[model samples]
Target: MEQISSFFHSIGTFIHSKHQQGVYNTVCLAILLGLPVLIFLFSFFICCHCCCCSRQRKDSSSSGPAHGKKRKKKEEDLWISAQPKLLLLEKRASLLV
Candidate 1:
């Protein structure tokens, strides 16, 4: 890391020296600054993509049957609970008729 930082420092010094003559120092500075930012962004996106893929795999494999079973059970319970209400309504209608 120290060597890499020293290398960049040398390059910055070189560009700074060249800046006085109005050369391509601005372009060099842009490239130097942009490269690390681009690399960081690329790595961040890759990590996010990998995490999302892993989560999707885990959820699909582990939650499918369990979630389906729970949903089906809930639907059945709702229907079962509604039966008495339907019976009461029918009795009321019969009494009214």
Candidate 2:
């Protein structure tokens, strides 16, 4: 624990010397702290979302068989709608490259 603190203290001194409090300091601080917290939160949100979606699927399937067809149709429609945007992205990427 003491070694860890000293290591971080040394790194912080190095960065602080490079930039004496400005946008660079703010960006460094965000990268050092905010990024990890945000990553953890994002992963947690995704995990909860997947679990809730799975439960809903199980409940819906058990409650109704016909609704599954409607759900599939909706999913297909969404995919069809998204294809044009995907193609546009590919075109833009190819042009940029």
Candidate 3:
């Protein structure tokens, strides 16, 4: 804490010196405005990076070395798509037939 205070105090003394008034104001204004802009951009970048990484991780993990990708047979694909309409016994029998 004391070190931080001394650092700022040194900066204050430097800025308050006769030749540096504009330097002081400019530095202060830049920090005041630019700090928030920097924070917003950093947060936005982190959020986007995290979301993209998560999606990639999920996709890769699902298709990783252990669980290989299995292609469904055409017959299986047909049954899967027609599953919603298979409620009727007659329709189910017709399909089997």
The lDDT values for all models are 0.81, 0.80, 0.76
Clashing residue pairs, backbone N/CA/C < 3 A, model 1: none
What does candidate 2's lDDT look like per residue over 52-80, in tens digits?
A: 99999889878876543336444544345
**Count of clashes, each model:** 0, 0, 0
List candidate 3 stretches off by more than 4 Å: 1-21, 67-97
**Residue 32 CA displacement from its true place in model 1, Å:** 0.7
Better of 2 and 3 by lDDT: 2
Q: What is the Cα-based lDDT of residue 36 in candidate 1? A: 100
> lDDT of candidate 2?
0.80
- Per-residue lDDT over 1-97 for candidate 1, one digit per residue giving the tens place of the 0 to 100 score: 9999999999878777777767577778778789999999999999999999999989898866654334654454434567788888878744454
Candidate 3 per-residue lDDT, tens place, 1-97, comes to 9999999998777656633566667778668769999999999999999999999998988886766668866535445565466566445544454
lDDT sort, best first: 1, 2, 3
